[model samples]
Target: MPAGTPDILACLKGRFIGIEVKKPKGGIVSPLQKLKIKQIQNAGGIAFVANSLEVVKRELSEHNLI
Candidate 1:
């Protein structure tokens, strides 16, 4: 598997989704992480770093990905 890949990968509402899980506090995204997320987005996919379940819900809802 590729390094820095998201923890969760799935198709939601006909869209490719990637979600990287992190700590609720003091979570840091490395440069590699930024690159990986950008790669997914560059391919017209949905990707996000979520520190909590609520954040995941918000991202999906806000983007209408679900």
Candidate 2:
């Protein structure tokens, strides 16, 4: 994986999804990670930082992937 690759990568309904999982407490997103997330989004992919399963589910639902 690349230096800032997201923790989970998936293709749902043909849409690229990148998820960066952080601990619910005190988990920080590094600058590199942030940059990668932005890059993915800019390239028309779905990318986000998630602190919990609920967040991940919500994001997917918002994108109509679930």
RMSD of 1: 1.1
Candidate 2 error regions (>4 Å): none
Candidate 1 segments whose C-alpha is farther than 4 A from its true place: none
- Per-candidate alpha-carbon RMSD to the true structure: 1.1, 0.5
TM-score of 1: 0.89
Q: Find the candidate with the highest lDDT and give its number.
A: 2
Looking at candidate 1, the ten consecutive residues that score lowest on lDDT are 57-66
Residue 66 error, candidate 1, Å:
3.4
Residue-by-residue lDDT tens digits, candidate 1, 1-66: 688898899998789998989999999988888888899999999899999999999989988865
Q: lDDT of each prediction vs. the true structure?
A: 0.90, 0.96
